[model samples]
Target chain A: MKNLTIPEEELMLPGHTACLGCGATLAMRYALKALGKNTIVTIPACCWAVIPGVYPARTLEVPLLYTAFEVTGAAISGIKNALEATGNDDINVLGFAGDGGTADIGIQSLSGAVERGENVFYIMYDNEAYMNTGVQRSSSTPKGAWTTTTQVGKVRDWKKEKKKNMVEIMVAHNIPYAATASIAFPEDLIKKLEKGKNIKGPKFYHIYATCPTGWRISPSKTVEIARLAVESKVFPLYEVDHGVYNITYMPKKNVSVKEYMLPQGRFRHLTEDEIKEIQSEVDKDWNLLLEKEKWTQSLNKVQ
Target chain B: MKKMLTGNYASAYGAKVSKVKVVSAYPITPQTTIVEKIAEFIANGEFDGKYIRVESEHSAMASCIAAENTGVRTFTATSSHGLALMHEMLHWASGARLPIVMSVVNRSLGPPWSIWSDQQDTISQRDTGWMQIYTENNQEVLDSIIMAYRIAENEIVMLPAMVIEDAFILSHTMEPVDIPDQADVDEFLPDYNPKFKLDVSEPMGFGSLIMPEGPFMEFKYKGHESMNNALKIIDETDILFKKKFGRSYGGTVETYKLDNAKYALVMMGSTASTGKEVVDKMRDEGYEVGLLRIRSFRPFPKDKLRNYLSNMKSIGVFDRSYTFGYGGAVFSEVRNTMYGKNIPIKGYIGGLGGRDVTMNLIEKIFLDVVNMSEKGQDKDYEWVGLNGDKRWSQ
Candidate 1:
């Protein structure tokens, strides 16, 4: 069995401004562990833009460059290349942004960076909506979920579209490493981040972070809800290395998607038939992911 | 070396001699060959710069923004829809005070998708806080780009600049351009050393949010002050460049035979060349008319224009673009500038959608200027040549 121990370094200083039980906070905490003090994080306008407090009181131990809302990807590429030009090529340049920034406004620049094969790490902390701006629906927001933009009201509501497949999109770029992680699985997340550190090209991480305020869940259930998210297979943990898929953690016993949704007030209006329908969709996607891993492993064996 | 080259190639040569450190590019009509030449320069090891192949013009400008923030010289080029898409990032470039230089080939915007010459493409971006300058010839295009860097990167004036040339008229048409040697260019333009940047050890944040009544207004004031100072620096650089290279375009507004003439024709871009040809022909015919060409639009050169216009009895402002319900873009500006004066100033709108602004048409416009001056009758506005369509005349 592999050792699943995480690093003890706390690059995220305490006395910061993140909300209680914010999974994005934990996501940054662990991401800093993977990329240590020798890292520079370039962030777009999102929740993290304000989480570090105002100037003279910023909580980040490492340097942070806050850029325009849709420019984190292009900013990282420019930063990395400028560092290379200046003879400081050994540091890691990480791009951190939210789902709205990653999946919608920022995808063009992100596509440009990966297409150019820039040496940088892009992390999309997916809380599933535009949480910082009062919980609006984003492209990464799951279908049938209630948001400010997709409100559950008479004559309309709830996100009709499915969540955007960001990991698959990164994998389509033929990037060296693309992974899906969760705040529930820190050891697995850290392990994948460590694996990505050894890779030389562009790496992407789509981390499933739960927004208690956005999801209308209890603050105390942040970790528990995230764990249920994985066990329910709604948020699978996997990595693709050069088109080879690897399911990092396979749940021993699958939980019902209902168990995952019943506690969150965001989905309180979901009917029984609606829950069963979402269950079928989750199962179908999980089976497809399993087949991808199986087929990729078989191809590796053949080669 | 002196070589006959299109205006696009001249733009690329200007960037090469300026020792640009990073070039982010997206291909668009007329501007495509400019980026292609820069790429070829990079591939041939003649130029040492990072060539970023962006997906769209937005990323191209975004990449240049960050690259310039890192204390290095950056450049890019686009036209038409590509430039329209970069509108958002163009404000960011100037608001953050990154002195990025971009070449805007003046192509008409689409609906009918015509890739022809029109000044409206650049005129639409007039309020974006970028220093806009129009070039008359291939040589002036090359020189203005270098001058753009010198003026933009000046400590007092840290803003982005746009060098615009008419599409196909200059971009595709070849003319003799004197490409200066590296040593002369090196002596002229020094290395860019920014005062602040994204440094890990130093740890400074850029583009932070401030409240409405906060430092926002003051920051805007500083940018405005810097822009107002560009006019003086432009004059200084023009004198210096002339001393070194034997070519000088008399600061922002270039005048020809306005010494004792009572009537003058005013315009910008390559159209000024056509206008100047007719002015000289009239001078040889003893018509006593002069030409005044505006090189810089952002600074507007009100004082220089006022000094000259204060002398002329009648002036005709020529604009290739109209602003709908209002007068022509340049004509409106000139009229507003000459508002307090009682001179008979008429506006002639012509040469749109790549329509020919023929020598005969220019001669006729000047002839009308002479006739209008004699009767002291000034028509507020008129479309010069539109295939003589009489429906609008009614």
Candidate 2:
């Protein structure tokens, strides 16, 4: 309820070509509120590429560069360099791309940018599937999701592999800032973005944006489902700073993972046993993350 | 003031005098010296810019693209494999129209992994929408870079430019280059003024999504028109550069001793130097053989090339890069230009992957062209410098 006080200033204008109740659109709205007007966004080929509308008329109030699907990292690095060169260090260079762009196609350039310690913020809006290219399964797509490429039937099945651990990947790079945010929690998402903006060197924000179009979910229940994801530990809110883990928000009451999945038709084929298996997976991941936070804290104490 | 300098130092000196704001690069052979000099310049405080030492060629290109989009005059250098690695961002930089200038030390792409001189790398990127210029010597390398900014940043042609030079042949071989004074360069190239920038004061959208058909076509059409217009700007800028610096070489194609020549040899890159030597030697011996050096690759200078070759008895094309299934890359383009015309054309696939195109090789190529013109029997394609054993084996 406290997060409802986010500034109502319309940084992203209406009449843009986003689908009805697009969670990614809301994510952009809130992100701009935190990053403010002094941000330059570099977007690779993704859904946001279409959402921003056509040239001479875009939804964003900030300067944006639409780069190749694989070069968002490089594009943002270039923008940051340009900013610094012109004595405009106050501006933030934000790389906004979808999970497919970040976790798959754009990974090499992203890794290179981060490894070089580029002074910029990279935000991967994870809606799971490659929504722009007609719901293909990206590496970030959760296991057991029925995508166009990962169809479920006899002899063939949904994605068998678990979603990639991008946060851990960012941690491996020892970036200055890396965090997981959810559109369901505006306060937490804005807080992470604002904090990321202040830190020097490469920072990453993996925001869980619900995709009603791709995920086969009700547009009206976008935020509600996104909230259930975090509450159920299906997508936990956490941050990693210089290899130290910090769980940003703890759910007041733990809910069954089924409560999060049952609402989405994308997961309708899962049996009760399969749902339980997914729950166990989420629990195991959350516990491992908790251990990492505790271990990092203890290391701080020893130091 | 003009000083004779090698092409490699000219590239370095061009970046130096341009007061480039950011330099991001990873070193590869041939291109390593360019960035090395840039790093030294930064260390010596000759240029005040952020020198980002990135891990790979990909990051180097990406960093500079970001830097340039944010309204900085960013500079980067690479060659061969390094250039290939930056392939994706090459499209991004030009499509975003960032006006980023890069110096490509030309080297052959690898399968056998040779780090010798050739034009394959830069030639392979001709479709990336960047204005590409080939430099003959140090002066052209220096002057083209300064002029590249003018051409790329033009309101009509706001695309990136790649100033390419032969790898070790030019990059490592230093000649006495007359370094332009900072003041003179300052007068020549003003501070880079971006038309639309990522600024806080006035927020705007750039490189945003263009829908399925309409927006994509519009952007592509504009890109095509801009590149077409760049032909005139390239020549105009060359004229301005000559007036200011008192020197000019092939604005599009450099013609040497074609006055009364019946047969002409056409080539690009460092091999053109050898071609010129052979042309002069043939001229001394009263042979009607001349040389034409193609300086600009993009905007292909089709008209200029056609006009130059129309009256020639026979035109010989020497290409350093291949088109794989097709014949030589430059040879195909020349044939396309000569299509519907009566000009006789002969193609020689030589100097590929850094093979030395010596004066003797030039003489042999010229002889073939002359033989083709006299006998009316044109050889489809011939590989130069291969020994009899190797030639038979292939």
lDDT of 1 by residue, B299-327 (tens): 77888888888778888988887787867
Q: How do the residues A188-301 of candidate 2 rate in per-residue lDDT, one tens digit apiece? A: 898888888778899999999999988898799999999999999989999987778999999887689988889898898888998888889999999999999999988988
By summed lDDT, the worst window of 10 consecutive residues in model 2 chain A runs over A1-10
lDDT score of residue B195 within candidate 1: 88
The numbered model that scores best in lDDT is: 1
Tens digits of lDDT, candidate 2, B282-328: 88898899988888888789999888888888888998887777668
- Model 1, position B112, has a per-residue lDDT of 83
lDDT string, candidate 1, A1-303, tens digits: 985489999988887676788999999999999888888888888998988876556778777777778988898887777677667778888999999999999998998899889999999999999999889989999977999989889954887788999999998899999999999899998888888778988999999898899899888989999999899999989999989999988887769999999999889888899889999999999999999999998999999
RMSD of 1: 2.5
